[model samples]
Target: MLIPTRVRPSELDRLIAAVDPDLRAPLRGRVDLGGTPLSRATLAAARNSIITPRPLPAPPIAARRIAGVPGAPPVSLYVINQGEPGTRRPAILHIHGGGYVLMRADDTFPQLQTIARAHDCVIVTVDYRLAPETRFPGARDDNEAALRWLHREADSLGVDRSRIAVMGESAGGGHAAMLALAARDRGEVSLVAQILVYPMLDDRTGSRRMPRTGIGEIGWTSAQNRFGWGALLGVAAGSSVVPSGAVPARVPDLAGLPPTFIAVGSIDLFVDEDIDYAHRLIDAGVSTDLMVLDGAYHGFDGAVPDAPVTRRFVASRDAALRRAFTPGGWRRG
Candidate 1:
């Protein structure tokens, strides 16, 4: 049996009023996927429409490609530098969210430029391979490779090696978490912090076994969750054999990972998992900060940037990043 989740009355009304009439209907219904060619085309179109570019003016943005591991395709990186030339600055490896199957690094240039300017850091957004084609480990490999490339070229890029951090939203957040874990285990680049925004961290979240109420309605739905996770894992969600590195929530130990910040909406599909992950990170002796905004839905901050709630959310995240990158600012618990 499916339990209906209702959005907070005020939020539902606000969202409905803010969205265009053509999109309002789809927002009310589940994002259906059949894994068929036509359905894939429809999904691509919907994803493109939602992320229609609203370019923001900022410092120069450059596009560059880095060589991947032997036999792998080259990875693209969008470089945004806000600091002066020849001055070393903290760097952020930003991953854009698209439910693991849509969007690109280019789609996030406006937001990335804002973060880079605010923090005065170098921002590199990775254009990783998408799924249902590139599947598990493909995107992960690209993210990890980008991190390695950053470290390898830190001096030339004017990046402060010790102050590097990884940041992402939705599926990208999941990738950031996995990258942090891989970095710890591999004893490679040391990350100062990780910022996850309403991350899609658990495959079991959308399954019937872990149902919740008043979530997954306005932005990303449970059906979309299943599709995204399935595409990445190349298997049905809630499977028994999900690889540890593929799913951050599946990792048994969160010890030795960097200090983390997570923000989510009270009524977002990822609220519970985000909260639980923060709890577990705390339990594992990692410093963690979590922000939950009542009555807000997933992607609310980006969708309704002018709203007070969205402003607060962005402010809190910016403050956290500032603290984390400051010398001796973030301390491990």
Candidate 2:
């Protein structure tokens, strides 16, 4: 399922040399596991093949269901590290990454539980319906429903609604962006921040416009990206007429969104799109922080958590969330 590299040997040599020393072993010799792309025929198998979450002593996690947008089924939520009844804590509505087709709400507890404990905040991860099965607006509706539930039931959940933020890595990150946009437009909930890690943003990145030399050669191939977006979009990924609000990058205006933190590996397929989106957000007067990690590829942090760069990326994300949660640290724009 690996997409054969079209990169020239010299170009590849340069890319290999540029890889962080600790993250280079896979690309240097062994085949990269993340290199596989999914087709309609392989979707089920791809969904079954999952990276076993790195186990940690998880804090208590409660299973809850939130009422969905009218007519849709109830949205499932995993509430992690909920605070005491008399107390209130900042909250994050986390979205799990699976290219918008794979993964579930519970899949992220192993890592998110640690963040919840360390930051002393609650995290509500949503189990949004997958695409090609659910298609445009179905997943969006589920996410919106969960965010609304998180806000409307903040008191019961021991959450400080004003301190709420949305976060995700990869496809989840893209959904977080869309959720933030929806929040701004609907005026029902206010978000303090968005933390996106190497998010899958633009539909045009791998299709329509290919990445510049040596980029996107490591993990999360362009072909897989097309499948992911196409499944969620219900049309050719780069098609001109996507349903409005389906793709965050396709949104015309970025104004009035909350403070944003985006981190992407320089060599990731989403690097160009992520950086471009950050710039567009900034241009729209949104507060933004962007970091491009040199020589890293998509999912680098998850792939090599102990690597110095991965640790640093995780620290940066934690710091951003910490500041966003702090009173007087982030102002609604």
Candidate 3:
């Protein structure tokens, strides 16, 4: 597939320059995953190379372990509180995106701290179990466990139970979407909103024969997507039998879900699925806000933080979050 000639020249330049040379070479045309497969070791090495010691927040965020449901493993939750000690603040349950296979809870602390300070809310980043070793529902269970723990200990943690929201990027976003559905079905918890940042929502997305989006050319390729989903599902990607909870796009209904905020680049691999999900949410009578960045690709905001497109993306996301956290701002569906 040829690179979309429709991409703005300036954005295309940034995309090419930001991607690694090796990746840039393959991105000019269709990528061959079979020739260069993504392995667990390779992914781990890449993650380690980028991992750095993040400085503590000014007031310091508390890090602690909380027990998951009776038999589940204990999960790590990073609590960022910028409000007064006793004041109940709106909370955001943040899930980090590593295709559901890589990255730790602390990898998201920098952004969590920023959001916590910006919104003056309690931010909790959950270190959910990763895949291959732990399959479907294992990671989801850990996230749900953290949510239950937060609500149960709300008073003590100074979190406003009524205003809690779930937010995440990529696989994390997928998890947030599933978590919202599960929470609704179980009738155990209520959410003010769900912020899905270019969520990886569909398994079939990996098999779709689509033109190369410059963004997917380098980072997060279809082959990688296949590996990630396969590891998480314990089955091949695009398998005939897969659980709706594991793949949000498969869910038959989008009703009863909280107001949703979805942002994706026009050229992202998940673009179609994200847009379709947004339309479905609106059709289901859910208040949905969708932002499609022109001439952008997957993880564009993080990949080029200072780019004009990225700045706009960050601003839009922060605005959506602020509105959701505001008292009585979210209209229950």
* Residue pairs in clash, model 1: none
Model 3: per-residue lDDT, tens digit, 1-333? 121223344565556665434334433543232234456767666455556448454546888798887778898887777355466889898888988887888776777777788788888888889887899888988899989987877888888888899999999999999899899999888999999998989887867544354545434677778888998998888888886588899898989999999998776788888999999999999989999987666766665567777778889888888889887676666
lDDT of 2 at 36: 40
**Runs with alpha carbons beyond 4 Å of true place in candidate 3:** 1-36, 82-85, 208-215
Weakest 10 consecutive residues of candidate 3 by summed lDDT: 1-10
Report residue 192 deviation for candidate 1 (angstroms).
0.5
TM-score of predicted structure 1: 0.87
- lDDT of each residue in 122-223, candidate 2, tens digit only: 999999999889997999899999999999889988999889999998999999998999999999998999999888888877789887877887767788
Q: Which residues of candidate 2, in runs, are more than 4 Å off? A: 1-15, 31-36
Per-residue lDDT for 120-145 in model 1, tens only? 89988999999878987889889988
For model 3 the local lDDT of residue 49 reads 50
Whole-model Cα lDDT of every candidate shown, in order: 0.80, 0.85, 0.78
Model 1 weakest 10-residue run by lDDT: 30-39
Query: Candidate 2: lDDT of 105?
Result: 77
